[model samples]
Target: MVLQDLGRRINAAVNDMTRSNNLDEKAFDDMIKEICAALLSADVNVRLVGTLRKSIKASVNFASLPAAVNKKRLIQKTVFDELVKLVDPHADSFRPKKGRSNVIMFVGLQGAGKTTTCTKLARHYQTRGFKTALVCADTFRAGAFDQLKQNATKAKIPYYGSLTQTDPAVVAAEGVAKFKKERFDIIIVDTSGRHRQEEELFTEMTQIQTAVTPDQTILVLDSTIGQSAEAQSSAFKATADFGAIIITKTDGHAAGGGAISAVAATNTPIIFLGTGEHMMDLERFEPRAFVQKLLGMGDVAGLVEHVQAITKDSAGAKETYKHIAEGIYTLRDFRENITSIMKMGPLSKLSGMIPGLSNMTQGLDDEDGSLKLRRMIYIFDSMTAAELDGDGKNFVEQPSRMVRIAHGSGTTVREVEDVLSQHRMMAGMAKRVGGQKKQMQRAQNMMKGGNKDQMAAMQKRMASMGGAGGMGGMGGMPGMPDMAKMMQMMGGGQGGGGMPNLGGMDLQSMMSQMSGLMGGMGGGGGGGGGGRGRGGR
Candidate 1:
């Protein structure tokens, strides 16, 4: 959505040039000039745009490319690649050093969502099995500690804070020591947001960093800043490691050219993007896919990975496979699959991640897609266990079931029917792919390859080919039980996904059921919240 304007401009230029048979050198030059102007208007650096235009010229020059190829398509690909290269060049590739706690201190101006970002980062690592803790060193901001504490409570991670104290340095040092004492895998130090030129505030931040010795120091910048990003980045980099950048508000319609192109000016790698305000809205920056989106192409690999990450615990997945092998697939597993998918974000957002969806999303906007997905989900939620597990013929035998679901979810019967159709299609596809190792391998390869074009084609074909019965297909496999119920059980509960629970129930029940589970859920158990529970790429 951020690139809609730029995409229109680029598309117009290409169309104007290739729509006619007249191939004069002057016409090509005019089109390239239009593109260059559009990029510059979008706050992209003149030099970078010039470089891209030159590349496009070289690629399309009569001397280089084959004459048979469509000039517009060639230009599109060339421009797309150049855009991808620009964003991908300086992206952060650094990982936490082996066997060491990667101390990352978040620094930003006030109202930049610094505290929220810290918890999201912690949650991200926590899911990867990292023993993560939080250091609330923002003594300057009133209630900063409490705001972070609430999120920490939700995540069930730990937080080190002193309401009565104002010395952020002491807080940082104590937090680091507490984390080390308990052997936390990662510790994230959150700092007070300050004005860019506040020397005294920066001095405190410097001292805090010296005390904790963080492995990574990230600066969170609001994407709304546009071209002014350079000055802000410079001011922050002057006082700290400024290891990576986290650009927030990217899901909006802002040009964001300033945010992305700032990489060219500052050479700071963007590590993550804040797509929304929620904890799970933070996503790792995938340079290539981002550039593709900017150039109006789809990003399939990123979409698939999003699905995999969010649905890894879905019913009939790895654990289900294990259970099925052991003969444990049950009704509970089906519910888990449904709940987990809901938490993973909207189905429309998930759909956008599929490659080659460029045309599929042609006339639609984010809000439109999201609304459709919500309606579809509503339909699914209204169905009973019997209906969920029943065959398509069962739904056909009783069309009133659709009317009931439609009324329950405040949707149309047609919408309910559409959901049922999708479920039936998916169930059929799963049956077809059952035990087909090669087909699975091919899909996996497409996902891993990270090529948007090829991946889109694969996704389209797979969608058409279909799968069956939600996650229940696992029930027919050898030794598998109901995976959906297990996922539902895992997904249910209070306080979200970061903490450990006992009583063998949802997150809330576990917290209420066992004190030890509570200890492990917060920072007190391992590294005072910044503990390293697990580590990986």
Candidate 2:
């Protein structure tokens, strides 16, 4: 939260300060000081803050710029650059090697969310259709095996560990052998959390590493420990090779800034973040989005991924995006939007990805929020195919249709009406923006400008989901607009298209219309909502 707050203040300062023609060295210095103070107060490393301030001052010089240039944008870009550098100097992209299981070993102290984090990593791979197995190598902690086993069961991933296993290195070796026997794509070894005084356990970890020869050795740290992270990281670095770090409890006021900012100081890539207790709460680390969120600008990567995932392969997905960018989105596109969103998990869940949205979604109860989203999707789904693909006028003209849909979807007619109203608003917005390609280009350009070389290097990574195109393609998805669109649609988003007027259309009529659309487009396909549509096929 402090990071978000600091980002907001810095954005405001740059914007407000740039309006003045009489820019002075003192002004720049003052702004840098404010930034340094904010970061330091947020528990960022003091030395890192000093270096960042220096880098920012050198990169942005308002006085030397032409009067036509916007000082605010310059400062914002500079700040973005500085933050990116601080978070990811090397910008290492994870690539599991070919022809062998990439052994990933997790190490950390107790209460660092290590067990949950490992499950999240396993889930990430499992969702992508990888053959992944979880290994509970933490024999030192009681119930640790149970906790990890529960997570593994939930993810449906194969796991190996003994409740009474005394030797951690042997347990780890057996776990690796089990996964290897099963020909799993990857094997993740979850080691015990040893206290500083647990010299024997720490020594065992090195042996575990030697036995496993892990491709990635990640040190999990509780973000709530700010300055202590440095010392802990140093100690762990001395014992085992830590390829990256997973900072847990980042969703709270955990001073993750220090842990993240000090990663460079510890010489490790901050690979992933453990934001919550759930198995699905881990988010792959993206430097640009982290910087943007730190500066209150919001996450461009998350937005893009969400949209791409939601719009995948639907009839109106890409076109609607194109229309959205061109400002021509219509009511029909709005209805499809609801359906698209249903394909995703929940609105509240996705909403958390945006900066400063945690507070806004605080009142959203899990049951009620999920119920609302489900009801809305069902209401739309129960309508005739034509109604979904067309406007209201093409559907039934009677009020009884709405009543039927409500009953069918198990929701009140008002909820269905609300869904309809939301569609209308979205349609209008899309109609206003005739094309999405330009907007996408602008977004890509902004990202490239902010994180160009780093992203380029990342793009070279092999595909993760499958050959040719997958999660491994240059981070997330590959290619522009289309790949981005697939990521969004799968991630979730509203689609494009002008539905026929639904103003007074009856529910039966709408359902019939929707039916026709589904049938016409090879309806009843059980494939997940996120895939290639448009020219993608």
Give the TM-score of each candidate: 0.72, 0.69
Cα misplacement distance, residue 217 of candidate 1 (Å): 1.2
- Tens digits of lDDT, candidate 2, 1-537: 325555656666665566657667677777777778777877788888888988998887755888798666777678778888888858474677545687899999988888888888887766555688899988888899999888889878889999776898899999998888778888999998887668988889899998888888999988878777777788898888687888888767544566865487676788777766766566677787777665554554554444443454466765554445555544455555555545545444444445555445445555554545444555666776556666564323666767666666655566556566555545544443333334444555655677766445434432343355543243444434444553343223432122211111112222332333222222222222221121110
Q: State the C-alpha lDDT per candidate.
A: 0.64, 0.64
The best candidate by TM-score is 1
Report lDDT (Cα) of residue 326, candidate 2: 54
Off by over 4 Å in 2: 19-22, 61-70, 91-94, 304-391, 394-396, 400-416, 424-537
Evaluated against the true structure, the overall lDDT of model 2 is: 0.64
Residues 1-537, model 1: lDDT tens digits: 455577678767877887868866677888889888877777776677878887878877866667687766776677767766767655454576435677878998888789999999898887766889999999998899999999999989998999987899999999989987888888999999988778899899899989888888888987767777777777887788687888887767777677766676667888888877778887777877776554445554454344445654444444533332232333223334344445656433443444444445455454544444444445556667666545556668978766676666666666556555444443443343333323444545665677778766755554444343333333332111222233323332333242211112222221121222112212211111121221111
